[model samples]
Target: MNIVVIDYGSGNLRSAAKAFAHAADEAGMAAEVLVSADPARILAADRLVLPGQGAFADCRAGLDGADGLAEALTEAVTTRGTPFFGICVGMQLLATSGFEHRVTPGLDWIGGRVEALAPSDPALKIPHMGWNALDFEPGRHPVLAGVEPGAHVYFVHSYAMTVDDPAHLLATADYGGRVTAIVGRDNLIGTQFHPEKSQAVGQRLIAGFLRWRP
Candidate 1:
């Protein structure tokens, strides 16, 4: 499969690319990992991976004004039903808005806001970094096929998504309280955790994404 990794000028594209490449190799699938800012290249791919880091506002600004790149992506994923996946800040961008510094509007593909993960305890860290266990919601989804409920995945985010439709949420994690970790609806899937950095479990998740069907 041809996997196009979107390079929107602010993301851990290299790590994501490496992870997908390694997973595809192990899974015996022909996958081409490309870091392209060009929207056409992204549109041409069988599947697209959107990876992100840094500020939400900056990333949104970069993506929105990407000289047709963002528009093409929205069309490809939302309109044409091309498979799309978002990671970390990329997942944040999928929300309706975010309040990091100010209220920044997001892609709004899913109805939600990227809000800070409020710890149930006062002493818990803000970013909620390190290995955290995922609680995948009951039922089947190709991306979480081999991934277990309560399985640990790497996480590093101060902000987390709160999707309006509970049906859109595929998985959650308990940091201090229940935290949304993975989301899937139709052809789109997103994760706040870093599968690329999650080692074996991470590879399995990516492989499942590769194996996902509409």
Candidate 2:
């Protein structure tokens, strides 16, 4: 399988690439993972991973700035049905729009909006950093195959995706209230947290993603 990790100038590309590589090795899959901004390479990928580490609008701009890269991604994932994995701000981009700094349009693959986390409690931090437990939905999708409920995962974001459709939400975490942890619809999946930095749990998720057919 040819896995492409998009380098849109706003992601921890090296860590993500290394994590995916380790997962591919552990899964014993014949996979070639590449970190590239080239549109042709992205279009040729069997599976696509988009990682982002900044503001929603900034990430969107970075993606759109790449000549034909956004269009290629849309064609490959939406038209060609290539499996897609979006992390952090990459996941936020899956929303219809975001409300950070302004109302910015997103990829709209998922019916949702990215909004700032309004914790019920005043003491909770803005960036919901550190580790938290996952509450997987019953009969979760294949991308979370071996992942268990209550499994700890690392997170580092202030805003979260508020999905319009409840079924699209695969897992959630508690941060003064419920926060979207994982989401999926058909061939696309996303995580609000940094799975690459989530240690063993992250590795298992990565491995599951590599073996996932849909």
Candidate 3:
């Protein structure tokens, strides 16, 4: 199998690539993990991973900046229904729009808006950094396969998603209130937390993605 991690000049492409490579090995799947910006390779991918960090508008600009890269991704994931994974700001990009520095349009794959996280506690931080437990339905999604609810996953972000529909929400994490951790439907899956940075729980998630048929 071929897994393509999009290089939009945003995320830690090498780290993500390494994580997937290791996951594939453990899963007993002979898969090739590629970190690339080439649109041609993207279109030919069996699975797609979009990882982003930094500002929403800036990441979007980087993806759009690459010739035919954005369009190729849309076709591969949105049209072809190839199993798609989005990490951090990459997950935020799946929304209809995000208001980080300015109002920016997203891929709109999940129909949501990325907004600043509002923790109920006054002392809580904005960036919601560090490890947090997940709250999810048992046996609800393929990506959460062996990962139990309350499992610790790494997170570091200021903004979170408010999905248009509850059916698309896979899991959430509590900081002071509900923070969307994982969101997906059909062939798409995303995490606000960095699975690469999230140790064992993260590895399980990566392995789940590798074995995921849809």
Candidate 4:
């Protein structure tokens, strides 16, 4: 199977590829992972994985100049019905717009704003990092089947998705208040947390994505 990870000059591409490679190996599936900025390559992908780091607004800007990448991605996922998996700031880009810096608009596939997780507890940190449990909401799909409600997944982000629709949210993590950790709407799946850094639970999540079919 072919999985294309979009390299938009935003984050570390190899790490995401390594994680997918490991998951595919464990799942006994022969998979080829490619990190390409070419829009044609991205459009032809069976599965599209968008992994990102750095500022949300900046990432959006980079994608905007990616020579039809933004349009291709939208068509690939929406029209051609290709499964999309997004990570970290990549997940936030799936929303309508983000308020990280100067209110940048996203792909608008899901309606939400990327906001900082509120810190009610004085002892809590701002950017929720390290290992945290994923609390599965309800109505589990194949992409999240074996992953239990309270499974720990690695995360490192300052902004979290404030999704409008409850049906889009698959799981949440307790940063301070319920911060969106995972979102799955139709063929699109997005994770605010980094599955690459998230060990076994993360691997299983990736495995599920490979096996998941709509």
Candidate 5:
């Protein structure tokens, strides 16, 4: 299987690539990991992983600036039903639009909007960095097969997603309030946390993603 990690110059792609490779190995799936921005490669991919950091608008710009990359992603995931995984800002891109610096449009895979996190508690910092426990129903989604509820996942972001439909929310993390931690609808899934940085739990999630047929 060809696992293409969409690379539109968003942060370091190597770690995410390595994690996916290791996950594929652990899952016993024969997969070729490629970090690229080529639309042809995207069309040929068995699965797609999008990783991003920094501002939501900037990430959107990077993806849009790429020649046919955005269109290719839309076709592969929306039209062809390719399994997709988005991380961090990549996950935010799944929203309808983001209000980071300005109202920037997103991939709209999930009907929602991305906005800054305003923790009700005064103690919680802006960037909810480090690890947090995931509140999810076990075995509800294939990509979260072996992951138990309350598994700690690493997160480093200030913006959070608001899903229009509650059904799309697979999991959440309490940061002064309930923050969208995991979301999915059909063949698409995303994580606001950095699974690559979540250690054992993260690897398990990634491996599950590799084995996921959806």
Candidate 6:
């Protein structure tokens, strides 16, 4: 199977690529993990991963900047229904819109809005950095397979996705309040935290994604 990590010039591409490679190796899955913006390669992918960093507007712009890349991705993921994964700002881009830096439009794959994290406790800091425990919903998504509740994942974001439908929320974390950690529907999955940086939990998540059928 061919897995493509969409490089839109905004993410920690090397680390993500390494993690996927490691996961595929450990799982003994015959998969080739590639990092590219080439439309043909993206269209030929069996699975697609979109990883992003920096601001919403900047990431969106970088994704759109590539020639026919966005269209190719839409065709691969939306039309063909290839399994999709989004990480960090990549996950935020799945929302309908993001309120970071003057409200930018996103891929709108998931029905949600990305807004600044408003912690109930004033002592909690913004960006929500460091590791946090995940409170995953029971038996809803395959991506959480073998992943236990209270599993710690690394997060570093100032904003979080507020999903329109409760069913779309796969996992959450406590950051002075309930923070969206994971979201998934059908073949699409997203993580607000960096699974690559979450140690064993992150590696397991990567393996799960690699083996996930949908």
The list of candidate 1 runs beyond 4 A from truth reads none
Candidate 2 Cα lDDT to native = 0.93
Q: Global CA lDDT of candidate 3, please?
A: 0.93
TM-score per candidate, in order? 0.97, 0.98, 0.98, 0.96, 0.98, 0.98
Higher-scoring candidate on TM-score, 3 or 6: 3
Candidate lDDT scores, in order, read: 0.88, 0.93, 0.93, 0.88, 0.94, 0.90
Residue 162, candidate 5: Cα error in Å is: 0.8
Colliding pairs, model 1? none
| Candidate 2, poorest ten consecutive residues by summed lDDT | 137-146
lDDT by residue (1-214, candidate 1, tens digit) is 8888888888689989999999999999998999887888878889999998988998998887678899889889998899998999888788899989989999888889888789989999888999989887545587898888878999999988999999888898898888989887889889999999999999999999999887
In model 2, how many backbone clashes occur? 0
What is the Å distance of residue 138 in model 2 from its true position?
4.3
For residues 5-107, write the lDDT of model 2, one tens digit per residue.
9988985998999999998888888888899989899889988999999899999999999888999999999999999999999999999999999999999
lDDT of 2 at 4: 95
In terms of TM-score, which candidate is stronger, 2 or 4?
2
What tens digits encode model 3's per-residue C-alpha lDDT throughout 82-107?
89999999999999999997999999
The full ranking of all candidates by lDDT, starting with the best, is 5, 2, 3, 6, 1, 4
Q: Which has the higher lDDT value, candidate number 2 or candidate number 6?
A: 2
Question: For model 4, what is the alpha-carbon lDDT of residue 72?
Answer: 85
Residue pairs with backbone atoms closer than 3 Å in model 5 (clashes): none
Tens-digit lDDT string for candidate 4 (10-32): 88689999999889999999999
Q: What shift in Å separates residue 23 of candidate 4 from its native position after superposition?
A: 0.9
**Clash count list over all predictions:** 0, 0, 0, 0, 0, 0
Estimate the TM-score for candidate 5. 0.98
Candidate 3 local lDDT, residue 172: 97
Please, what are the lDDT tens digits per residue for candidate 5 over residues 102-159? 9999988899999999999999998999889999887778888889999899999999
